[model samples]
Target: MSVENVRPVQSNCLLEVCVDSVAGLECAIEGGADRIELCSSLELGGLTPSAGFMQTAAHISPVPVYALNRPRSGDFVYSVLELDLIERDIEQARAAGLDGVVIGVSLPDLRLDIGALTRLKTAAKGLDCTLHRAFDLVPDFDVALEQAITLGFSRILSSGGALSAEQGLAMLRHLCKRSSGRISIMPGGGVGALNVPQFMALDGIKEVHGSCSSPSEAVHAKVTALGFASESSKHTDASKVRALKAALLVPSSD
Candidate 1:
């Protein structure tokens, strides 16, 4: 079904599955994901996907696809040249008819780079803009949350500055309370069927993100022989995605 045709779950909470490959896209769709974040290397915390990958995935994906806009790996801070490149990529994502773009920029002090973020949002004028996990890198969560809201991000993907949503529940809850409907605080990182209920129980959380990924031996064998690939090229498992989605849709009796 097309994204427009897919109905929201009874609970009204959204499930966003992060995927790096077309195979993973198919799995997410088959498993009834509410949305998909398209990227290349999830191991490096997700890099911008190629134009071809974005186009192909957009063409076939049943749900809306949001492209990650980071130019390179190490940090959220970008040089002028890198910012230009990121702008170009955002345009490419728009041209490819993607539903949205995920992006973030921070200073050395680990604060939101408002200037860069403004320019990037301008470049992505028509697309939904999600502030990615770069929120987790910020030194102050409250200040960063206000900054993201001021920058007009549709949502902020975060793990509460912790390694996983479970680990950061306190901060996540605080963000939701402070947001007060001005912005969305979407908890990501290590969210799964096993722990989604804990997040769902939070008062203001309306969305969640996860890779729902499982190791694929076939994928491992294909890349490991190249002498450079680690056993980290995982694919989204449809069954796992289904379980996660099912868990979110059902109300917790506890």
Candidate 2:
């Protein structure tokens, strides 16, 4: 870790909760999340939230809310049309009074697409930016970390190039050290209250992210059979958020 950009140690770890609906947003806030990552289609790994969702989240969430700017599912590699869509989505986030935006662009080879990221960063000026988990797909983490820093992203939301933060503890620690104070490394993916202690144990990991969603409830059999919704869909639980915040010593609206 460079001494010059030494990351400051936090007195308490912050909890960033991901929410895909107004109900989830309310739950996260009621549960005491310090930050919110507002999005849609979380099962699709989170897509850019609708303008209405962004606006509503800004109005209701007392905590800083960062809107996911991803335009689609599949890979982060984007076409000109998709890039244009992403640019406008970012503008919408800012116009909706969001606190920040989460974004990433990748090459077909699984490396960060510097040109595309640069363009998106310019559009997101005046709002904080987070390099979202498209980072997990990077072929090289060290090179990608430097790219994120050079891009002026406030932080990188990653799982240490792994599927979950717990499984990637080693690499996550290294990233914490590598980032020093130049930027923050926020671990997400399968992180939650019960096992959050494992992640907060890392030195530079001052913040963590997760869905805090409860298991999907059984819906009417016909609902799934008719394709109204997936039987496996999960919903955010206020109790789970409160539990996590309690574990982290964060205050809640309750």
Candidate 3:
């Protein structure tokens, strides 16, 4: 394949898998995920993982792992102390050899908090930075896109303010086009193997994010004996990952 063709084929659909626990991390890596976003308390919409968890995830994950640095989950609005905690987490993640940091901050009015973001970026000096799905909550997607680039974010995880990626594909494509290579517009939320082909069919999308989940039937087991395995753990399945990858190849065939 020509380099340009191969380049897009290889990276046109980056799979970002979110892992709630160590088992989820292993599943994402085994499932052919290109990268991972590690966090705890998905029930609270994902808070920063503990130091021990961060260390273990970085060591075990085969693909690059990015730590979610949110101190709490209620909203993207953050306190100064929470920002400080996030900065410290970023430092720890980098030292632990994690690849990046996933963070978000916004004004009470739901606009990107430019000043807070600038500080967070500065703290993550040596690591890649991704503005998390909180981007979708910003009042103005267009304005947020511009600020993300200007603030030097490497990528953004969003769902176009919708509940799922499919619903947001139109806006996702628009953001990707407007980004103009200045930043990467990554469509996340409610992504799965079933929609990979549809997402690939849309123009300008280069990456996708999701937590492909199946119920953990073995939920009655305790972690002490099973060693961190949850009775209801959600992990990326390798078959699903391969299916999604294959689906992305269809456009090139056409």
Among these predictions, the greatest TM-score belongs to 1
TM-score of 1: 0.93
By lDDT, rank the candidates, best first: 1, 2, 3
Could you estimate the TM-score for every candidate? 0.93, 0.92, 0.86
Query: Which of candidates 1 and 2 is the stronger one according to TM-score?
Result: 1
Residues 1-254 of candidate 1 have per-residue lDDT tens digits of: 45335443444589999988888878888788889999988888899999999999778776789999988889898999999999999999999999999999989887999999999999999999999988999888888998999899989998999999899999999999999989988999999999999998888889999999998766556568886677656778989988999888865678
Please report how far candidate 1 places residue 182 from its true position, in Å: 1.1
Which has the better TM-score: candidate 1, or candidate 3? Answer: 1
Ten contiguous residues minimizing lDDT sum, candidate 1:
1-10
List, residue by residue over 43-136, the lDDT tens digit for candidate 2: 8999989999999988777778999988888999999999999999999999999999999999999999999999999999999999998899
Better of 2 and 3 by TM-score: 2
Quote the lDDT for 109 in model 2: 98
Per-residue lDDT of 252 in model 1 = 66
lDDT of each: 0.88, 0.88, 0.79
Better of 2 and 3 by lDDT: 2
Prediction 2 TM-score vs. true: 0.92
